[model samples]
Target: MTSADRLWPFLCPSHPDHDDQSLNPVAADAPSLVNLECSRVLVCVAENDLLKERGWLYYQELGRRGWIGVVEIQETQGEDHGFHLYALGNEKAQDMIKRLAAFFNREMPPLL
Candidate 1:
């Protein structure tokens, strides 16, 4: 199955047989993230991930659309999709977890 198919259950409205909306962000409009209140965005992508380029494109698009907050990406070299989840003890994973914690603890400045 494709990545979108795998993500559908998590990111989209449920299929005809399922009615779970708990995991959905409830945002019908996602491409236009102008309404997002967060001041900083962090996107992490493995070097060989299926969505690597797409993640970068998303960051660039956010900038193109005048995102006022800082946008950062942590590209894990020589890794595949979901590497951190499966390789929890790996150095890259540890670093990523630390970075994520730091990002979460950071204070967000007012949007530009």
Candidate 2:
């Protein structure tokens, strides 16, 4: 199981409204992927993050389901989850920010 799958229960521990499928989109039925409402999607993942697998899974599912939207996954080399938040001065973090800006503005440069 992916780290996100393993941690779903604890995300809202002691709460009555815990939905196991809430944490991982891959947990839902395959056909349900069509229900995701978006014309574009960007999944940013850290190369060394424990949850990176989940990001990949979600990205793959979008393609496997033949969803009618552009989906992209960008992996930041040598970074951990949330590194952009913790190390804003890092070059990789700055690159990620620029990439995100490009994604938001629909100006995604061809992935290098």
Q: How close is every model to the real structure, measured as TM-score?
A: 0.70, 0.77
Provide the lowest-lDDT 10-residue window in model 1.
16-25
Angstrom error of the Cα, residue 33, model 2: value is 1.9
Candidate no. 2 TM-score: 0.77
**Where is model 2 more than 4 Å wrong at Cα?**
1-8, 14-19, 29-31, 107-112
Q: Over the stretch 1-112, how does candidate 1's per-residue lDDT look in tens digits?
A: 5564476566555452122323222223344555557788898899888667667876776677766778898999999988888988999999989999999998876776
Pairs with steric clashes in candidate 2: none
What is the C-alpha lDDT profile of model 2 across 1-112, one tens digit per residue? 6565456556767532333355457664333777777678999999998778878988998888767778989998888999999988999999999999988987434422
Residue 15 in candidate 2, Cα distance off native in Å: 9.4
Q: Rate the local accuracy (lDDT) of all candidates.
A: 0.71, 0.77
- What lDDT is obtained when candidate 1 is compared to the true structure? 0.71
